[model samples]
Target chain A: AQSVAQPEDQVNVAEGNPLTVKCTYSVSGNPYLFWYVQYPNRGLQFLLKYITGDNLVKGSYGFEAEFNKSQTSFHLKKPSALVSDSALYFCAVRDTDRGSTLGRLYFGRGTQLTVWP
Target chain B: DTAVSQTPKYLVTQMGNDKSIKCEQNLGHDTMYWYKQDSKKFLKIMFSYNNKELIINETVPNRFSPKSPDKAHLNLHINSLELGDSAVYFCASSQDRGQGANVLTFGAGSRLTVL
Candidate 1:
């Protein structure tokens, strides 16, 4: 089974500072990773995805994530964090070997990010 | 326009009652899915439908049945709702060609509260 792990429950960062949200995965085959953000009482919005990509993938709202094959990690990053960027972040993984599990994404426990102004 | 939408943004019902959450996607995507977000914010896929066919059915209870009427609509009906079922249910759609991974567009989510 494919699974994702987000180690931190919460992360605090100051405005204009760089921020990082850690994510790791365990999959039997090649992994397709994604990052999504959710505001209070709102549905999740897609940020970016890493599917056989060039490791570092950029996304909406000045966000980016680096897919590390050796580390089995895909960490979301931002050069400068904004107060509005504070939201719940989720890391999900999908196994390339579809088989019976067709287009099913295994999500992480989510991490709350707070950017102080 | 809302690409993906779910009816009854907030649902409050008593235990043992049955309720249904409706979802529709105007994105013309052939694949639709239902995901449950627990109180702890852990998300799990409950069911998936491709072209109105059940493609992925997770280890969900029989009480929770997902019905896809057409290629764009998928509804979830839960019988004998329990307090543990109180959580936000999200409806998402994607264009999966059975070749590679595709991005999913999610609805605003329906919050279910079983008292």
Candidate 2:
């Protein structure tokens, strides 16, 4: 079965420092990867996606992810972290097999990012 | 206006009660989905509909029924809700199926607490 794994249960980073939340996926066909962030008691918001082309994908709220096909990893990254950037991050993937409806998303358990001042 | 919205953001009901959560998306997308987030914050896809046709149905309980009146609306109704049904439910919509890279627009999830 296709799935995503976020190894880090929690990542603590100091504000203004670089931050990285790791994600690895297992899929059968070409993978369409995505990153989403959720603040406390809020809905998951779209951050970025890797469909095709471009190994580095930039997204909203100054977030980006690097897609590595050989390693089957799509790690979320940020140059400088902010105190407000603390939230739960999820990595999801969908296989582009024939007749795939493109609705169901296999999501990771989520990584909690804590950017402290 | 919220692009995707789910009614009754917080639902507290007794076990065995039948309840329904209504969802509407104004993004003009062709596909809609329901995702369940467990107490551990693990997200899983429960059901999906494209243009009012059921396309994806995961290993969900038969008590959970989804109705898509149109492309813009997909409602979920649970019969004899069990205590294990307590979780956060999210409604999402995306463009047409087979769009290679479908970006989903999600609503503020409805928190269901079955006591």
Candidate 3:
């Protein structure tokens, strides 16, 4: 079974400062990791994904995530945060091994990010 | 234009009443999914249809049934609405489920409140 864990429930950061949201995953085979952001009363929007490439992956809205295989983590980061960046973030994972369950994303609980000015 | 859209943005009804939520995707994708977001904002997949065929059906209640009339449309109908069924339902789609980089595009979501 594949699963994702977002250790933090809420993360508060000041605007124009750096921000980090942690995410970890467990998969049977190769992992396809993804990050999504959702504002209030809206659906989730895709941020970035890591399939099989460089460890560092850049995404929308000046956000980036580092895929650390050894640590089994993919933490989202931003050099500068904005007040509009406050939203609910989710980390998801999918197993590459195709047998019974393929292309199904197992999402974490979610992390609420609040960037204050 | 919206890539994925769902009807009935907000729904409020009694516990015994039944309701249906319609979803459609215009991205020409082959896969469509239904997800439920609870009060705490935990999103979970309920059903997925690929090319008008049932692909993934999670451990959902029998009262909830998903119908895919075609490749571009997937609608969810609840037989007997309960208070526990109150949540925000989302419709999502992807190009295909065979690849590794299949990212899901979601709709705006429909909020259901059962009294």
Candidate 4:
């Protein structure tokens, strides 16, 4: 079985300040990881993914995440926060051992990030 | 044109009734999936179809049936809808189950409210 955890239920950060949303995973072999953002009454929008290569993956809207193998963590980070960045974020993982699959993702409960102006 | 689309973005129905959510993808993807997001914002996979063939069916109720008429279209039909079924249904698609990447393009979601 594969699973992900976003330990923080909610993160509060003031505008123009750096922000981080934490995520961790439990799985065997290599894992495919992703981050998605969802606004109220809207579907999730893809952010970034870590398949392999560089430990730090950059995504849209000036967002990036550092993949730490030792920590089993992929934390989303932004240099500066904006009020519009307030939303629910989810971390998901896919197990490659399953098959040549667009593997079924195991999602975390999601973390709500608030950027206060 | 939308890459992945679903009809009736909002569906309000009564318990014991049947309803269908239609999903279509134009990205030439060979794999499609249906996911349920509960009120608490928990996501779970209900079904997956690869090239119109059932691939993964989770521990979902038998009342929930998925129909894939073709590779580009996959529809979800719920029988005797229950209050527990009131949640957001998301339609997603990927290039293929074997393309190595599991990145799914999702629809806006169909909000199902069962009374």
Candidate 5:
């Protein structure tokens, strides 16, 4: 079975400070990891994904995530936080071994981020 | 234009009533999915369709039925609404089933409130 875990329920950061939302996964095979953001009463917006290659993946809205194979973690990061960046973040994973799942993504309980000015 | 759109952005109905949420994608994707987000912000995939064929059906209740009229349209119909059924339903689509790495485009979401 494949699953994603977001360790934090809420993360608070001051404006201009770096921020991180932690995520880890469990998969039978290689994992395809993704980060998505959701604002108040809105659908999730794709942030970034890590399939293969570079350890660091850059995504929209000046956000990025580092994929650590050894740690089984893909944590969303931002160099400097902005008030607008406050939202709910979710981490999802797809197991490459599960071909029958067919584009099904297993998501974690979202982490709420609050960036204060 | 919205890449993915869902009708009835908000719905409030009494228990025992039946309701449907319609979704459409203009991105020319071959796979579409329905996901439910609970009040605790936990998201779970309910169903998926590839080229209008049911491909993935999670451990969801039989009362929640998903119909894909075409590759671009997927609708969710729920019978006998319950208080526990109140949640946000999201419609999403990806390039194709073969492209597992493709990211999904999601609809704004339909908030359902069952009284």
Candidate 6:
């Protein structure tokens, strides 16, 4: 079974400080990792995805994620945190095997980020 | 313009009743999806339709059926709703499905509450 795990339920950071939300996954084949953000009472917005390129992939709103194949992880990071950046973050993964038939993404439980002013 | 839109942004109904959520996308994408976000905020894929063909169905209850009238619209119908079904439902679409590179366009979402 393919699944995604967000180790932290909540992450707190001060404004202008660096922030990281950890994510690990277990899958049978190569993984296509993605990050999405959900604001209060809103739907999820796509942040970034790791396909088959550089380890570090940059995405919207100055967010970036690093895909570590060895560790089976894709951690989202930002150099500076803002209060508006605080929201629910989710990490998802999909199998990339040529024989893979299930193309749906498995989402993580989600991590709440609270950035203090 | 909203790329993706879902009707009944908020739906409040009693248990055992039936309701339907409508979705439409204007991006001209061929694939659309319906996802359920539980109370714990875990988003799960319920159904996926690509070009009017079912592609991914994740063991969802038969009570919940998805209808895709065209490549741009996918509606979710829930029969005999249960309290546990109360949650946020989201509709999304993508240009195509593959190595997960396609960016999904999502609607604002519909909050379904079963009393």
Question: What fraction of the correct interface contacts does each predicted structure contain?
Answer: 0.71, 0.73, 0.51, 0.68, 0.71, 0.68
lDDT of 5 by residue, B20-79 (tens): 999999988988999999989899999999999998899999999999989999999999
lDDT score for residue A55 of model 3: 94
What is candidate 3's lDDT per residue for B37-62, written digit by digit as tens? 99999999999998899988999998
Question: What TM-score does candidate 5 get on C-alpha atoms?
Answer: 0.96
Writing each residue's lDDT as its tens digit, candidate 1 over B1-115 gives 9999999999999999999999999988889999999899889999999999998898999999999989999999999999999999999998866532477889999999999
Clashing pairs in 3: none
Interface RMSD of 4: 1.6
How would you encode candidate 4's per-residue C-alpha lDDT over A20-81 as one tens digit per residue? 99999998989888999999988788899998899999998999999999999999999999
lDDT by residue for model 4 over B1-115, one digit each (tens)?
Answer: 9989998999999999999999999999989999999999999999999989998899999999999999999999999999999999999988854433588888999999999
TM-score (all chains, Cα) for each model: 0.96, 0.96, 0.96, 0.97, 0.96, 0.95
What DockQ do you compute for every candidate structure? Answer: 0.67, 0.69, 0.60, 0.69, 0.67, 0.63
TM-score of candidate 2 versus the correct structure, residues matched by position = 0.96
How high is the TM-score of chain A in each model?
0.95, 0.96, 0.96, 0.97, 0.96, 0.95
Interface RMS for model 2? 1.8
Evaluated against the true structure, the overall lDDT of model 2 is 0.92
> iRMSD per model?
1.9, 1.8, 2.1, 1.6, 2.1, 2.4
lDDT of 6 by residue, B35-73 (tens): 999889888889999889998898899999999989989
Candidate 2 local Cα displacement, residue A27, angstroms: 0.9
> What TM-score does structure 3 among the candidates reach?
0.96
Local distance difference test values of all predictions, in order:
0.92, 0.92, 0.93, 0.92, 0.92, 0.91
TM-score of candidate 6 on Cα atoms, chains taken together = 0.95
Chain A TM-score, structure 6: 0.95
Query: Ranking by DockQ, best first?
Result: 2, 4, 1, 5, 6, 3
